[model samples]
Target: MALGSLGLVAGALLIAASSRWLPGELPSYPPAQNAAEARPAASLAIHDARPGQPARRIAEDLIAPPPLDVAGVERIEPRPPLGELGLASPPQTPMPQDWRETLLYRPVATSSAIFEAMGRRVVISGTIDVDPDRTCAFGDAVWPCGQRARAAFNAWLRGRALKCVLPPDVDRFGVAAPCMLGKQDVGAWLVGNGWAMASPSGIYGKAEAAARGAEMGIFGPPQ
Candidate 1:
């Protein structure tokens, strides 16, 4: 029995010695041991070890701005109500009414006539005024369109009454206003006849376009 035990012990010792020489897994270490192995002793000494400061992880060491507190921040003041500013609303002007008046014999221009009652020159609205000395092109030839336009206007007027939308009090200087010859709008007639252009107000744009398309009066051969 003693000899058998001695042989078993010898066999165990042999097995241990052979296992140590064989391939095996490498030993593992804790995180503190790993950091100590990676860094130099001088680099580790530079870190602060002051009291009251807790050791920080990589995530905690990152820079981060403080969160904003909207409720605690100062706010801008709002503007006061318009009524409390002591301002008054602007006054509106009433529209002028139509008035009937007789003309002083003839029209001064294709788009203007003299009112006999007020002796004030009223330019027909919606028509651009053409100087009496102005000329126009007709197939490479120029003609006195302005004079012809005025003559045509004079013939149409023939000392007749005009219905105008003018103020009751006459203007010291001339003013442009809508006028009617019987039931016809004088401005529309002038623009439609191609004797005058439509004003920038676009009131007679269609009429001017029609006359231009048809090549009538000044837009065509002189009448």
Candidate 2:
């Protein structure tokens, strides 16, 4: 009839262009509201509300208790109470030069003597009672006989050789007072045997007076 009315108007415009391109069934989402603030305000204020029992004795009886009159607090004077201010009694530490000890023999009127070897060396010799005519020529120049001949020539130069003894005294010229053959240095062997002359304050007085004036033993002949 008009091509059946234009084929029913072209099938109703292809069903309205396929219901406007096919996708419409999503509309049911409403379940997520926790905006967070139902009355919450406690950043840190419990001050030991006494729950279990010992939070440091309830935080030191509720918050601050330590300075009860520490009175001026500077103190440092207690060391004096141990020996009470006299502090010098503790300083006697001097005995180690190899620690040999034992020197008290008393009897060298001079003309020295000593010989004790085997270590601790001692060989001093005799006839040094010094008397170039006396005005103090060396009994160690007098007084307790030069302190007992320098304590018996320092106790035979400190022991060994049957404990080197000898201290009976007799020097104004007698001679029995200078003995010690065991510990050597008999006045540097009586000044190397010229009978003795070295004492310019000794240290082997000029090499025992040039080896006793070059062997004239007793200061003779070497001009």
Candidate 3:
């Protein structure tokens, strides 16, 4: 009987010690009155509203827009074909290593002719110019050979166009250039005819020799 009473006392002491040391029951959270209140307003609105119309316009905006009305929209028209590409004027034939200029000549000396090119005056090339007043002697007779040579050259030109190869850079006056009249070289013709001497560095040496041998122009009896 005494041992049973001791046991009862020991159990009462354990209960008292635990109550003092352990934390009180956590404060009970108030029971949620409305389950909808616990949820977000947007979700609650969607759940509470009737199903016919959208519950929230903001939620409706998230849905992808209806497919584009391809059949109703207009399409762009294609561009017209471009006109055939062409130059304003006919293209000139290309020549290598030289500019081909067309010039009108007026004989100024036995070997030189004056012409205008790109608004500049130019003199013919490849010969030693002979003065218009120069006189030539064949045996005991003397003649105005320079004037005659000029006249002959002028007659040959007769206002025809000459295709000339002139320096890209030329002086204001006395611009010497090689020219062609049909198939003939003007300078070579002058030297070959003995009306003028070939320039020191010119290509008319053979023409000059031939003229000398034939005794043509100033080398022959005045003609």
Candidate 4:
């Protein structure tokens, strides 16, 4: 071999000799004589000697408390099919006592109601504007005004009976005359509650004034 090749071989032999791994690079450890000791050292350090046992598996209670009286516990009976009693029923829109003399009203799921009076079936004249889809600044976030109004109205009207007084005449569109719930006018209530604004004709001037003053309904009051 060339002189350079011989020098390289000698240098490598010197390194291997110093490390004591010269002739043959043997296994890291001696082979186990039995199968029981064949587990890797890493596994032995991380877990108990018991093979296949979980680390979190507890064998006994560390502190025992007084026994509970489970034997005397009352048995639960089968549930009846009557459904949830806590849930209230939906509202049934009031029907007119007399078709010719009264106005039948069915809410259109909104401030407006379906009206049938004076031999005509038509929608009531909505003298108010409720911006249900309008998003306004409320605290740190904006929220839908219409949804809140609808939910509040439905929750209040549901399960409770409502009475109204209707005028004896019909409007130009065959719509029923304006109605009122007690002394509280329907249009006035809607406006006064903040769900609606006063009509262009200012039909609910006082109601609108009250609602704006109190910051009610879909109108998020100024901060």
Candidate 5:
């Protein structure tokens, strides 16, 4: 009985020592939240609600009207007299050095006294009244001057291409400003042969006078 009492006392002392030394219970937490409650709050937007059909009428009032001409499309049309574009007319291109060698001259075709050769419409520059109806006063009678001019020009060319200098710029008919055949001036030739007349410009009066004295081509033989 004394041994049993000692054993009980030892067990009671171990329990008390454990209670003093061991850790206390952990602090508690609330139950887990639901998915909906956990979501973030959204920012708010302002809106004014309309009462009725008057709001629809107000929207129609904001609409735009149809254009003046619904059926026609707008177009840009170019009109004549281009001066409005604020640019002077462009100048013609200059002749290249190689062009002189390639005249590929054929006998010129004459309409009235205007002749075309090497793709240029050349008249005796500054000649007046050389066209078909122009008259030559030969002796006492008058005859068509352009006819004699054509024949004379053909005879002079004799089926050989003449090298000519085109103008630095071309004219409306695309004739060179000045042209030549060898040392001879083609325009002067026409005047000297009486095939053309010096213009009021009077640049070739001497040639015209010489032809008149000789009575060649357009200047007919004595009546």
Candidate 6:
């Protein structure tokens, strides 16, 4: 019994020594699978996934372009050029009423005829008709003979109903050669007939001493 007991104790020691040497049966631990690391791989597969269903179609309604409206516009008419028309006629002016009638008339009888016919037909007598030489000789000579002669001649014209147109100059004798009576050159007729002579002084200056010195017509005896 002691030997058996010794063997049993030895067997028990071997069992204890084997247990220290050998590892326990680990609770079926799956090969340390990195589940956290596998999560990224699963997420990448979902991100790269293609659309299996038909793509959603978007509805679009395009508006048509507006039509152009050009109406009711007025057009300007062109005017004809001035050169196209003929030259314009000048405007007529009215003449004066008085200018239309004649105002002058010629005489029939000359100075000689008129003088000869004095008293009967025409009479011209005044201090004016007296020669300036005869009148100047007397200091008390009244009436300016030359001036009176012109006045008498003018008066004769008035009496005859004729215009008096006296010559520019007269002889010392106070005789006008080309005296005009109503536009009639009576003096010219007298000078032409050698009855009166041309004078150097004017009709008014015929009485001057210088004019007298000329001894023109009626100043000296009939030549």
Model 5, span 19-52: residue lDDT tens: 8754545433675567755665442222345776
* Residue pairs that clash (backbone atoms under 3 angstroms), model 6: 118-122, 128-148, 128-149, 177-187, 178-187, 178-188, 179-187
lDDT of 2 by residue, 120-170 (tens): 223232234433232223222332323333444445444433232223321
* Span of 10 residues, lowest total lDDT, candidate 3: 84-93
Q: How well does candidate 1 score on lDDT at residue 124?
A: 79
Model 3: clashing residue pairs? none
Q: Which has the greatest TM-score?
A: 1
TM-score of 1: 0.51
Model 1, position 95, has a per-residue lDDT of 44
Q: What is the TM-score of each candidate against the true structure?
A: 0.51, 0.19, 0.49, 0.39, 0.45, 0.19
List, in order, the clash count of every candidate structure: 0, 22, 0, 1, 1, 7
Candidate 1: regions farther than 4 A off = 1-94, 97-118
C-alpha positional error of residue 184 in candidate 5 after TM-score superposition, expressed in Å: 1.4
* Model 5 regions lying over 4 Å from their true place: 1-104, 111-113, 167-172
Window of ten residues with lowest summed lDDT in model 1? 108-117
User: Whole-model lDDT for model 2 versus the true structure?
Assistant: 0.42
- How accurate locally, in lDDT, is each candidate? 0.69, 0.42, 0.69, 0.54, 0.61, 0.37
lDDT of 1 by residue, 8-109 (tens): 999999999878864555454553466677888755533445689965434333447667798999878988776533744333233454543534334444
Candidates 3 and 4, the one with greater TM-score: 3
- True lDDT of residue 143, candidate 6: 35
lDDT of 6 by residue, 72-178 (tens): 55678887667623744333233334322112233323332233222122211111233423222223334333333333344444445333322232212222122
Q: After superposition, how far is residue 214 of candidate 2 from its true place, in Å?
A: 49
Q: What's model 6's overall lDDT? A: 0.37
